[model samples]
Target: MGISLQKGQKISLEKEAGGGLTRIVMGLGWDAAKGKSGGMLGGLFGGGGGESIDLDASCLLFDEPGNLVDTVWFRQLRSQDRSIEHTGDNRTGEGEGDDEQIKVDLAAVPANVKSLVFTVNNFTGQDFSKVENAYCRIINGSNNSEIARYDLSCQGSHSAMIMAKVYRHGGEWKMHAIGEVGQGRTAEQLLPQIKPHL
Candidate 1:
């Protein structure tokens, strides 16, 4: 068990690990909300039931001035500098855990990069109200141990969420849980909503 983060809470990675971390993995998971039966006909025809949600996890690298440097997402599995890599896309949120994952080599990250923002977008255009049990967690890559986790309990009509961010602070790495919901289907479309947090 690791530290469970509340919305807007921040934690130092170095302090949590008891030392500097070389690499880490940000895992995102979610499932579709089970729909109520719409009468006998609905159940017989599978009208009202749980449907698969296609949520995409993305990492956006930003500089000190909040300019986008590069991104790692389903389309682009690897960052331009090669310091970040997305495991792959999981279309159906039907598995047990971590529908999508983005791995980062903290030490290998370019010096000019100051922050890495993690986001989840409902790419299939379904609002988050149709989602359930969504969460974002950080795991130490070295030992596969969870360092911290933030549950995305905000269920609404929004189509996207700015989950959390790992940023440099005072020569050390720290994480902040944003948990902000908005409208966007891709990282590029979410840029405006992301600037306020930067």
Candidate 2:
């Protein structure tokens, strides 16, 4: 069983798995909230089946001093160094499990890249009030086992969230659930907001 992380909780990846984790996957999932119109009527009037939200998952690499290093998202699927890659963009939060995934080769990351911040945003500018069952999970890429997951079930009006972060700690990597909700449709806009949390 995987561990469920609360906001602000931190866990060491190496300590939890009892070995060095070379690769990891950050998975983001969500379900669109039901529209204002009820069941049958909603389906008939383009309120249900016709509606979709585009929530984008991104990873921002930062140096030890919190300097922006690089980013990986829909617009840029892979980092310049190829250490991080976004699987694809999910136009709608359909299906079960992970709607989007960002794979990272921890062992291949540059030495200067000391921290990785994960974020989710409604690229369409839709508020989180219309999103539900939102969650982020860290999976061990080798065996596909989930090491930890953070459920962002707190519905609100914010359009973006600094979901979690992984940083170098004592030569090992650790994860922290930031879970800080704010207003931003892209990672660039959230830069200032992510500073204090680092």
Candidate 3:
């Protein structure tokens, strides 16, 4: 598996009303084109040049083998306090991220925490559908009976940040399809990206 990790970016979770958390591990990976023009705009009207992936608002979770969450497709699981890992990798074609691996220890989370959220936003893209084969899964802390996942790259659009859902699943505290908010074709605005689901 190709995993990438930024020095200061990774998964995160916090709960104020729950018992206590001690360990949190997050895995992140993405496919790189490494050819032709990069995903990020090389020069906006011949202005600035930079990397290919901007990850100031991305997170990870545990899931299956074939399942995947590519780029900006994991917008169905909405976190109350959504985790945002920024790495400044904003291009999609020219270059690649650090190591395709990220790490987060739950034990390191802040105390007195209440609720958590996972949101993927603020990506420079020519289209949203280009961000394909996306998915996410959250592993349970108790008995590990929790399992939640969603398909995030189905819509036809090619350039829209999404808000994934985050709620309990199977009676075992879990995260499910909190629903998507940016990939909708008709929903032209950001509000429509997540409001109708509410």
Q: How do all models score by TM-score?
A: 0.94, 0.93, 0.40
Top model number, TM-score: 1
Give a tens-digit lDDT track for model 3, residues 20-136.
433332222233222324445524323333334332235433222212222222342222323323223333433332222122234432232312234443255434333434433
Q: What is the C-alpha local distance difference test score of each model?
A: 0.90, 0.90, 0.33
Per-residue lDDT tens digits of candidate 2, residues 56-137?
9999999989999999999999999999999999999999989999999999999999999999999987778678899999
Better of 2 and 3 by TM-score: 2
Q: What is the Å distance of residue 54 in model 1 from its true position? A: 0.3
Q: How many clashes does each candidate structure show, in the order listed?
A: 0, 0, 52
Candidate 3, residue 5: how far the Cα is off, in Å: 24
Predicted candidate 1 versus true structure: per-residue lDDT over 1-198, tens digit per residue? 679999999999878877868999999999888873476644553466666789999999999999999999999999999999999998878979788999999999999999999999999887887788999999998898899999996888899999999999999999999998889889789899999999
lDDT of 1 at 74: 95
Q: lDDT rank, highest first?
A: 1, 2, 3
Runs in model 3 with CA error above 4 Å?
1-22, 26-56, 59-90, 93-104, 139-148, 161-173, 183-198
Q: Between 1 and 3, whose lDDT is larger?
A: 1
